[model samples]
Target: MARTLAEKVWDQHLVRKGEGQEPDLLYIDLHLVHEVTSPQAFDGLRLAGRPVRRPDLTLATEDHNVPTLDVLAPIADPVSRTQVETLRKNCAEFGVRLYPMNHAEQGIVHVVGPQLGLTQPGTTVVCGDSHTSTHGAFGAMAFGIGTSEVEHVLATQTLPLKRFKTMAINVTSKDGRLRPGVTSKDVVLAIIAQIGTGGGQGYVLEYRGNVIENLSMEARMTICNMSIEAGARAGMIAPDETTFAYLKGRDHAPQGAQWDEAVEAWRELRTDDEAVFDAEVDVDGDALTPFVTWGTNPGQGLPLGENVPDPEAIVDENERVAAENALAYMGLEAGQPLRSVKVDTVFVGSCTNGRIEDLRATAEVLNGRKVADGVRMLVVPGSMRVRFQAEEEGLDKVFTDAGAEWRSAGCSMCLGMNPDQLAPGERSASTSNRNFEGRQGKGGRTHLVSPLVAAATAVRGTLSSPEDLV
Candidate 1:
């Protein structure tokens, strides 16, 4: 039978098929855990006297509550310290591999997995965090699981899940490529804006066509990382030469003859030409510009040159209510130019946009420029390896010279579990995913943008694009 790429991968890992309303049991190839969500699951195992069924496939990292400034010092917050220590204790007892804070390999689970060649095509991957969809960039069947499911997978190496319908997001341009300065982040923000936040509910999104094919692996990951925000079960791209090239030499990737065999198998991991999707959406990549979110949700966005939307003008009743709430929380006035909204902070890091390429892009824009007076800018790499690469290329110096704080990596201000966060009523132009109220800190406002836009906003002290500074 002709199959979609997702269907092909799903069938490959199917340990048991569903009958009637029963969920199918799918084997998990990679299980990633973090401090915030795993402690309870570990305790569940201990209470039941259940051992981790496949410790070799499980990995743990400390990121959600770790500080970015001090690597060697003990965590100052009692709650944060306990979380990290508990993870250490659990991993030690369970025999699962862990990359603790200050370890050379330590970083965000999503970022570290791909960097270490642990995320590969045609594999089933899961994590407790929602952004685990980030691994789908490699054509893996990756999605987030809950704590109970975490225990289930740890105990059985399998998850009971309902099969998802597929949605094809076909992005193309009249010229067959995105315009320069319109990045993958812009493309994704534009998608959410077009479809609204719940458009992909109960669906697995397949990003395809010319625009997707042209994007680099890092850029693809950035797009897939936000699929959860769009309410998709996961998002994926078909494995191709770009996917193969990115995984060829990583630490955990197959080597020698095994590598050749793996590549041969991965080459077949694509949708059949005639396979159909439940729904389809098309985006004009050329028409997209650098985008920024004006309201709370990722969908509440517009091109950089647009104005804050008027809530009363919204046609949908629910949308109008959401717009009103967003405007009230954001301190934005109707019809105010988004570019005129001043910012108190500029953050350039997260699993969504904290790779070496993201840092390099921000550095290129900040190259001889200074951050606006009084606007604090924080540049946290996604992982220790990314930090080392950035420093080796001197990208760190460019950011520090521009007055941004170059700090060690963890999931810093993206969700504000640690010290890197905004003060009350503070507004920021950030490169991370999501801009919900208090996502960065209590009473904080977030404007999500691309790295280029983030650097430009840091200089201009407003939501901006590189053209604004140029």
Candidate 2:
């Protein structure tokens, strides 16, 4: 039978086929653990007296609650300390490998997996994280699971899930790529803007065409990481020479002759020419520009040069209501220029855009430039290893020279879990996913942007793009 890339990967991992409404039991190739969600799952295993079924396939890291500054000192927050300690004790008891804070491998679970090359083509990956779709950049069928599902996977190394319908997102351009200053982050924001947040519900999105294929692995990861915001089961890009090049010589990737064999198999993971998708969406790469959200949801976005949307002008009743509510919550005036909105903070780091490449881009923008006096800029790497690499390349100096704080890695400012959060009523231009109400902290406002935009916003003290700096 003809199959899509997602379908082929799904079939390869099926332990048992489903009939009627029965869910198909699929084998999990990699299970990632973190401090926030694994506690209850580990406790469940303890109560049931069950050991982890595949310790070798499981990896844990400290990220959510770890301090990005003063890493050597004891955790000042008692609640965070307990969570980190609990993960240590549980991993020891369950025989799962853990990379604790200050360790080189320690960072966001999604970032660590790909950097180590454990994420591969035609594999099934799961984690207790919504951004697990980040692994789909390698052509893996990855998705986030709840605490109970976490327990199920830990004890059995398998999960029973209903199959997902496939959707193709074809991105084409007159020049075969995005223009300078526009990036993968803009591409994804444009997608969510075109398709409302629930547009991809129950579907697995496969990104294709010249625009997608030309992106670096890190850029592709950024694209997939935000799939959850679009309400998709997951997002993926078929593995190609770019994928193999990124994996080569990584710590966990296959070596030598095994590498050749793996590549050969990975080449067959593409969709068949005659395979059909459940739906299709087309995006013009040439028409896209640097995009930013003006409202609470990812879909409430416009081009950098556009003005805030007028809710009264919207014809759809529900959309108008949402726009009105979003404007109220965001403190934005309808029809005002987006560039004129002042920002109090600028954050550049997260699973969505905190790779070495992202840091390099930010540094390039900030080179010989100074941050606006009233704006505070924070540059937290995605992982300890990423921090090391940036420092080795002197990117850290560039950040500090520009008055941005260069902190240690671990999901900082991406959520309310860590100390790096926005104060009440604070507004920021951030290079992170999800700008929902209080996503960064209670009563805080966020504008989702790319690293280049973040750097420029830091310099201008407003929502901006690199062109504004020029």
Error of 1 at 376 (Å): 0.7
Model 2 scores a TM of 0.99
The digit string of per-residue lDDT tens for model 1 on 1-470 reads: 88999999999999999999999999999999999989999999999999999999999999999999877899999999999999999999999999999999999999999999999999999999999999999999999989999999999999999999999999998766888788999999999999889999999999998999989999999999999989999999998999889998999999999999999999999999999999999998878999999999999999999999899999999999999999999999999999899999999999999999999999999999999999999999999999999999999999989999999989999987999888889999999999999999999999999999999999999888888776
What local distance difference test score does each model get?
0.95, 0.95
Error of 2 at 106 (Å): 0.4
Candidate 1 segments exceeding 4 Å error: none
TM-scores, in order shown? Answer: 0.99, 0.99
| Residue-pair clashes per candidate | 0, 0
Worst 10 residues of 2 by lDDT: 171-180
